[model samples]
Target: TRATDSPSPDVSPDPSPSEDGDNSEGAVPEGYLGSWSGSIDNASGHSTRELVIRQGEVGEAVLTLTAEGPLATGGTYRCVFEASLTAEPAEGEAVRIGPSTVTEGEPMASCTPGSPTTLTLLPDGSLSRENTSSGEKLTYTKSG
Candidate 1:
């Protein structure tokens, strides 16, 4: 979740893959699929995030974050957000998703339910997850 102050990112449904070829309008480009994980350990606290993406009506994705320590208000918190990939991204462009839904683990009066995120595939194959709302970012690697 994120703060409500930041501007919202555009949200749109991903298009179905065209039968003609693999380069469909909404097809998730290679390297954007599968599961990825990242973590943050700093003065604020420690958080671990996981993202799982798979083909669906649109490119489907679920993001989960589990955190503890001061950042989490000294308590553990887990949040899950789901959304479809907005569109087919060009090579090297970030893949954006959300205006997400909080399916679970929202603490009382905490955790914004609808925040957008952008995922950039890094040179080392790590996925960088950035909150469009708060500018918070994390780096994730492919997970088994």
Candidate 2:
């Protein structure tokens, strides 16, 4: 991932904490708490995504993501997903969350309600979200 001191000009960082409480098992690390935004221009079309992660149950984190992009046929498509993620063991400064399950975001057949994703906290403080199934990657900076 690219290391930069700041996010993109159009990307606003929202560093606000999602909750105020002691860290618990499987809770997202303090560094990974908050909102992140990023975009990509691939063959599918230009798409922008925003992800919000919050502490969840004893062994899970709540991830809410919204993505919008142009459809191949025409027009734009928007999808929202709420997933339950579990922390995976990692080395060094990287934190990995995986085995994501889409608890919601139904009624949209295009949305993958059962696809697992990899969420990594890079050393530079940016978040890397990867779709394990499609191999789509998006680097996001903390929202401001």
Candidate 3:
């Protein structure tokens, strides 16, 4: 049988559901909430950032980044970022806004987020994300 396409690809007047019943409740997966740590380095120096994600019922995730410096004048710094994520096509997914990653590295990420950050957990307990604007690839390794 031939499949028909919907007129509007976005914000369709009629919405459909998925198999996982992800839409049962508009919220993020419980697994997304937790702490992720990674090492970040640059020409300036090396540093680390730990993210503590707190999610709400609506799949909204609040992240806190405790970072050190890669610059000569750099020192230990902490940045707090709040973003509301929504799995529009499904559920438990979200989009966020933030700085773009300046560079890439091992252990952790060196740069930042371009737009809102989209973070997903990997089976190995690592969090991988691509900076929205710059598309700088970053993967945060687990500390424990």
Strongest candidate by lDDT: 2
Against the true structure, candidate 2 reaches a TM-score of: 0.65
The residue pairs in collision within model 2 are 12-144, 13-143, 13-144, 14-143, 14-144
Candidate 3 segments exceeding 4 Å error: 1-26, 57-61, 74-76, 86-114
* TM-score of candidate 3 against the unseen true structure: 0.55
TM for every model, in the order presented, reads: 0.65, 0.65, 0.55
Report lDDT per candidate: 0.67, 0.69, 0.56
How well is each residue in 24-73 modelled by candidate 2, as lDDT tens digits? 44545667778999998978878988889876653565787887787776
- Order the numbered candidates by lDDT, best leading: 2, 1, 3
Please list the residue runs of candidate 1 whose C-alpha ends up more than 4 Å from where it truly belongs after superposition: 1-18, 21-26, 42-44, 57-73, 106-109
